[model samples]
Target: MRIHQLSSAIANQIAAGEVIERPASVVKELLENSLDAGADAISIEIGYGGLNQIKISDNGHGIIAEDLPLAVAAHATSKITTLDDLYAINSMGFRGEALASIASVAKVTISSKTAHQEHAMMLQVQNGQHVLSPCARTIGTTIDVVDLFFNAPVRKRFLKNEKLEFQAIELVIKRFALSAPHINLIVKHNGKLVLSLPAAIHEQAKRDRMAKIFGSSFIKDAIYLDVERGAMRLYGWISGPNYQRSQNDRQWVYINQRMIKDKLINHALKQTYDGMLYPGRFPACLLYFTINTAEVDVNVHPTKHEVRFQQPRLVHDFFTSQLSAALQSDGQNNTEQTLQDDSSGVTSSFNSKLYDVAGEAINMAYSFESTNKTSDVGRPYRFLEESDERYESNFYQNKLELAEPLTSQASYVAPLRPLGSAQAKKNLYSDIDECSWVALNNQYSLVFIEQQPYIVDVLVLQQKWLLEQLQQASTPLESRPLLVPVRYSLSLKLKERIEELQHYIEQLGIRSEWSIKEDKLLIRSIPIYVPYLDLRLFLEAVADLQCIQISSLLELMSQMQRFDPKLLAIEERMALNQFLLKVQNQKSQFHGVFKALSADDCRMLLHV
Candidate 1:
């Protein structure tokens, strides 16, 4: 194939494969452009899964007549020019590939008019070619994209169902809306208006806007955060400890007024929360960070959603501090009091505000009047006192209801009976004394030799089990002792200990020596029983064991050789079963005792 320059139309279509993969991608790109153009109010309309038709209208500073054609051309952007501009990029769509990419695979009509212009100009682009000139139109910009991916049959087939595609579009709109709380946004899917928000300026307004977009429940549990450290500024609302979602869809982070899915910030937020929250559950947050533009590179990606920060650690630390402070302040407040106070008057008042003007006007009129005043004069004073007394009684009753129960059925208790009990007295008089091992009511194991039961500690039994297993297994040690004497180097301290215990090691067929050059102790051989022992651990275990004086080395040998694998396994299983049974018995005992107490109390009340 001969090398030749590719045409602009072909190049744009190829770029569309990357920049405009689906309807959501197109929505994201257009929304970003609207935000960059200072759009305070934006509306999106989609039909037939954004394949048959899609329209995005923005009340922003519209493009001029000369810029209309360039806007649909690849690599044509007014956001940046010089090399230095790459580092200081503050616009959301600096690459200017969105329009060109969308125009390549769809029929696009951009009707735009600047605030200074008397009439708007419209340009129609089909299959990466301008089919119509700029015509007169209304103010602002209205972009209508129809038959998306019509030129590419393969891409069209990959498009999802209308409902799913509409959801994707909604997701993109949500990101933009979260990033720009001051912007009013409206979204329509198949002629149905799914979202509409008035312009939000104040914090409460922004919260209300978010509630309308997300849910009122989110706003209820949100914590406001605003803090600055050195060159970094952090501000936003985050969900409280008690508020969490199954996934991270609710988490939104924007850097330099551009929405980004950065993992560093997410990790920092999670770290602040620690393990107090459940795994896979994410805290809802809308975090915004502002840093010096020159200190960050925004040209790293085509979508401008990823950035390279000069000091990521600083950003992480700032977020961690702010989030921690917000959570700590929330913890200090009495949530019950706050919730009660809010529910009594504030929440009711706020809920009424969501209604129409007529309802709100009626609410206002009733809200200001003294609710305590009664129409009837004679019984008014008596009624007021009675109402006050009833309210006080109900408050106390509520407090009592909320209090923790003193005696719960779940508490654990021991099952053993006292010696003076009737059952113990009966066992004492029986032939249990002659039995070598008597099971205490089929519960406990008691060994008898001279008319007395010998009780063994459970922990001691566990240790014996481990020792038995070690003895029966092929020893996991390296060095084996030989009959012939072998010299080895050793440290001064080790040499002294070895000399003192030479007879002891010789009996086991091992030898050692002190080497001044190496300044260490070296062993020639180990016991035959533990031929593959770790030299260090074996020596340490021996030293510690030897510290306790015994009558004879033969006794020590017998003690070490007592471990047997089969017996050990049996012992361990038996011990585990015993422990499990003990725990169950104790739990049952607790329940029985609690039930008896409750019964006794009921009987006493009946007698009274």
Candidate 2:
């Protein structure tokens, strides 16, 4: 076949293939035209998912009676005249191909009456054929596109199901609704009103409109953004970390009030939300960007869904810094509030007699240690020395085993049993309400409540305590300087990502630096509590942070060591007992991450 110039009707049908992909495309083009014509309010009606009939009425500046024919003509636009105008175009519908291409494939009837005109003029076109006539009165434009894709049978075959098409149409309407909150929009599908958004002229009204569209739950977790850099201004609502969705469909990005899907902007957004969200989850956001008309090319795509930026790098950096700052600021607020609440909880806990005794005992023990600092003994010192009369039971001597010391230079030392003298035990158990506890096999505690013994997993209490400590820590955990720095080799990409997140990583108590000569990452410090953490697993988990949180790493650190009662120091065991006592008194049972028997369970055991 030889190359030849396509006929006028074939050319238009080809253009329609690009612009009119579905009913949503038609809605988008018509809405843009309405918005470009300065419509404050618009109404849309759809039938059979816009395949049978689609009517749009808008109170905008109507086309001139003479220009009505030109409106349906190819390449004729009131928005732009020359190629130079494309560089600085502002109107949403500049190519003017929408009406002409749509008219070529569908039955189009455009009726309008300018404010000065007494009667409206109606222009009807069917497959490039036209008819002009005087019609009833109307102050604005009313376009009825019936039997869409009537001439293009192949295109009609590609149309989606009615439900899917209607969903797409609603999605497009929602995009414009968010972009121009001041535009009152009413939408009907098969005579049932699906959406009716009033004009949002004020900030409160705009927020209300957003809540209506996105839901109140999203609004509760949304952070408002307004950032400007040079010719670029970014403003909108971004969902917080807690408001992530399973899909990216919830993300709405707009450039100069025109909804778009620019990969550059989306990549920047992903970078901002890298460590903030979980894996395979997307943040629900409505981001509006305003840049100089000359700085952006909105004609990059036929559907106007993509744009080319003059300085893509600069825009990307601006978005990253501004959005990061906003999220970080919100996080800091939450952290401070948490710290305050924890402080209040500590103060309240001091009012309890058992809690006060624990605090006093710990303080007195620390004071004793400060005075004994001059002693040169290498062995671990006991906070509470056992009396000579308190005999070490076979349970402690035969069954207990000491854990390996944390540091390489240290050697494991046998742990001393915490059993007190007869008098001390009597004093401790006197207020127990006919209950007694005996450490069972060093793994469980058999608590005899009202003469019935119930087994309890001590590890459950330990896990709960560890979680509470990790979650409510007012300051970062204590970190120890490494005697020899740990080195990790990495690919260039992973290295760059780590360097980008170096600041955040350091804040989490792991200090790392890139070795210039060796070309490997050097870890200089680590949390003191988790001395045996697997550095490779920790770094990889941190690098691939989408699946978990930074705090989760700390939780992992705590979990690496199994719960062991014999390994705990005397003070720690006492503290565990105090915690369990509190739980029993408050709730009559301990309900930890692991299920432990309750007081009711203890009673049920006696019955059985």
Candidate 3:
């Protein structure tokens, strides 16, 4: 074949392949254009999951009659003019490929009436051909797209069922709605009103809008965060430890009013909840990050769902520090607040911060930033303290519940005197010896270092040990073949999912073979770590392939730790001592494990 320039239609269809993935993609682009046009009120109408027709009406400044033709022309945009504008882009539709691409694959009609125009001018593009007509309308714009993927039939096959596609479209709309609470937006699916959100005029109105979308439970269980570091500000509601999602679907992150799914932000948020949550569980977050436009690049991705920060390290560290500070002081300094009724008639309020079993607001945020104040990154993190209220009066009334029982030896250790819970003190033991250890109540161990005693909760120690073992395991853990292979009958869908995750499952030391004839899966072996757990129940619980990872192993170990350590033989006790010694040598506080008491704390607990 001779090399020649492709036709305009072919070129546009190629661009559409990248910019348009599903009905949600089209909705995103059109909504972005509406937002860029300064539309405060927008309405969306979709038919048959947006495959048959999609209409978006926005009450914004309409385009001039002359610019109507140029609007559908590729590479023609009013957003940016030069290369520098690309780096610090403020508008959402800067690339200008959306209209042209949508026109190439579907029949599109855009009608507009500017303040200067006497009548509305309509432009239609069908099969890559253009037609213009004059009509009467309001002083705004309405774009109607019909027969999506009519030119490119192959793209139509990629679409899911109408129910699933509409779900995706609804999710996109909700994201935009949350990102811009000032906008009055309504969505209709097949003529049925799915969403009707009025413009949020006050703080109460904004809270009402969020409650309508995310539900009242979220507001009740979430921690309100407002913190700033340098030029960046992170503010939003992060669900407390009491509330968690099995998947990260509820996480909404917006940077400068633009919804994004940047991996850096995701990782940073997940890192914040390091020890508080186990694997496969996600905290519901609605975070908004505001940074100077020049400090971040939004043009990195075509969909603008991802961005590259100029100083990613600084941005990440800042998020970690600010969120950590918020989580730390959340329990002690929380103030009660109520939400006023909105026009929607739904009102909800939060009276108290979510507290953990320890009676402290669960601090999921772990500080990962460097500790050195003078060595580069900046100052050490300091939490905001409430001076108005003193520490909780019931601090010593609550007992620290140990998740596991301690190993007891009457001959080798001294008796433990009852002590109340000590006020939280930073850092752990500076000096210690094995001779100063004493087991207390078969729940915790008291260790004296430098003539000061510190409490070690056995449950915390067991959980930490189990988590480390699972994470450090060499992949493809040692497996033991079963004497009689276990068989499980499963649905076709479940069988397919198991087949898909066969590779990961094997890495955890479980081997399986499919028996299509019997509609069953034959398990050949089991991982040595999870021998006690019911294999069938475990397999069913880890149905999601994403859960079949180190997290799953950790979950299994946590379950195993529930069995008493008192059952172990004397030989086992010797081995356990070596393990405990290793833990003592390595600073426990540094790893989110147990923290030892300072000398001052020891005296306070003893009433010295």
* Candidate achieving the largest TM-score: 3
List, residue by residue over 51-136, the lDDT tens digit for candidate 2. Answer: 88899999999887899999988889999988889999989989878988898899999999898887899999986778999999
TM-score of each: 0.57, 0.59, 0.61
Give the alpha carbon lDDT tens digit for every residue of 124-213 in model 1. 988555754656655678899999998999988988888888788878888788788888888888898878877889978977777766
Lowest summed-lDDT stretch of 10 residues in model 2? Answer: 364-373
In model 1, what is the error at residue 593, expressed in angstroms? 35
Model 2 global lDDT (CA atoms, 0 to 1): 0.68
lDDT of 3 by residue, 1-608 (tens): 99999998899999999898888899999999999988899999999999998999998889888999899989999999999998888888899899999999999999998888999999999986789999878988999999999877789998998999999999999999998888999899999998899999899999989887876656765688887777788899987653545578889989988999889988888888874443456778889999988999988877888899999999988877877777766633431111122223332221212232244432221111111111111111111111212122111122211122211210111101111123311111211233255666433566554454556555456555555655665777655565444555565556777788788778877788977775556666655443233343345445644545667655554433322233332322333343456676577353544456786786787995
Which parts of model 1 have CA positions greater than 4 angstroms off? 1-4, 115-118, 335-608
Name the candidate, 2 or 3, with the larger lDDT value.
2
The clash tally of candidate 3 reads 0
Q: What is candidate 1's CA lDDT for residue 339?
A: 56
Task: Write down the TM-score for model 1.
Answer: 0.57
lDDT, ranked from best to worst: 2, 3, 1
